[model samples]
Target: MRRGALRPFRSFLPGPRSMFYTTDGPHGLPHNPFMAVMVPRPIGWISSVDAAGNRNLAPFSVFNGMPCDPPVVFFGPSGQHKEGGPKDSLRNIEETGEFVCNIATWETREAMNASSALVARDVDEFELSGLTPLPSTLVKPARVAESPVHFECVHLQTVHLPSKLAGVSALVIGQVVGIHIDEGILTDGIVDMKKFRPIARLGSSDYTVVDTIFSMIRPG
Candidate 1:
């Protein structure tokens, strides 16, 4: 291609290199460099209502859903503390037993990150984070208008894990009630990641974009 400009190393480069490890240590490797270098994590902009009917929002990367009979999704919240306050999203979901998962995109990355702040329970993350709260047709909680996809869900169960030497962790499972997708993102009756440009979390303070895509067809 471009005249002798160090032809991008072909076979010399390894194929998508990564190192996987688990954290079972005290404090789980304080400030894990894993996420930052991991580069991009899918964000679950969770919305929930407190027992008092107050709303809360927060982002978590330990999130994914399964296509079981009723469609179930789950998220993990670390029992970490900042200024000795409870996580607003986890607390609200525990209190209200309901939440909405909104898929974050590049357009809404800043707003999603804002909701990650350690705000008071009563503080409305939508307002504080300057994110638009769109009413959910099938769920009590509202969805983030800036998000490209939204899944209205009801809490099914929570698996509490022992903290041992560190704070506790919780696995929250939610049953999907409704799904919503942006019209612009739907092309040829399919949602494209390139158009979605979904954002993901990396360990620490790093993040990544998700437009790069490829496909492989498995033998039927």
Candidate 2:
């Protein structure tokens, strides 16, 4: 298959139905399906430090890579916390312009969930979750020691999205200045998914793990 080539997907299911609704309108469902529809999103276990040098760790489901030439990635924090402010991760990134993106895996799921608790600005999630923090070479924030992969990033900018709700959401974009990968997960020089065993977010409190692998060559 050539680049930009189209592949037909044949489905035996019924044809699509009109179930779309405006963002401002109600979907008539018990829970919004937006997050569920974007199933299995990569979790960015973000670590940062405040001006006072207090470390902060949090997991953002709305996170992913943005570019490759400069190796960029981003995580978005939506809504204000119970403290009535932006998340500590976002605030710390703004304060110091540095952060580390740690890849969350099945083994660290519990710790990840614990770190997501809305704690105070001075609180360190590493200690709260009982996870070890490894010093980063290129950033002030420490990387999750249990995580197999880490991206030491320098904050580039934050884009705030207009929202109808009281609180706004922002995307924190950063340039990956350094990366650490565990050699144990490498298979023939490539990171093996089976060994990595990464976990991802789903709707509500649901999560899924990556235990299976398959590949297909792109058409050229």
Task: Please give the RMSD to the true structure for each candidate, in Å.
Answer: 5.6, 3.8
User: What's each prediction's TM-score?
Assistant: 0.81, 0.91
Q: Residue by residue across 1-220, what tens digits does model 1's lDDT show?
A: 7884767665644445644455664334568665565555567889988787778888889888899888998988886555454576677777777899999888888888888887656689999989888999877788988888999998888898775535558889999989999988988999987898988887767788886799878969
**Model 1 ranges with Cα > 4 A deviation:** 1-40, 80-86, 164-167
Q: Which residue pairs of candidate 1 clash?
A: 35-202, 35-203, 36-203, 40-208, 41-200, 41-201, 42-200
Best by TM-score: 2
lDDT of each: 0.81, 0.90
Residues 1-220 of candidate 2: C-alpha lDDT, one tens digit per residue: 8888988898767558757788888888777689888988999999999898998999999999967887999988888867778878888899899999999999999999999997776788999999998998977899999999999999999999987666658888999999999999999999999999999999978999999888899979
Q: How many pairs collide in each candidate, listed in order?
A: 7, 2
Give the per-residue Cα lDDT of candidate 1 at 7.
70
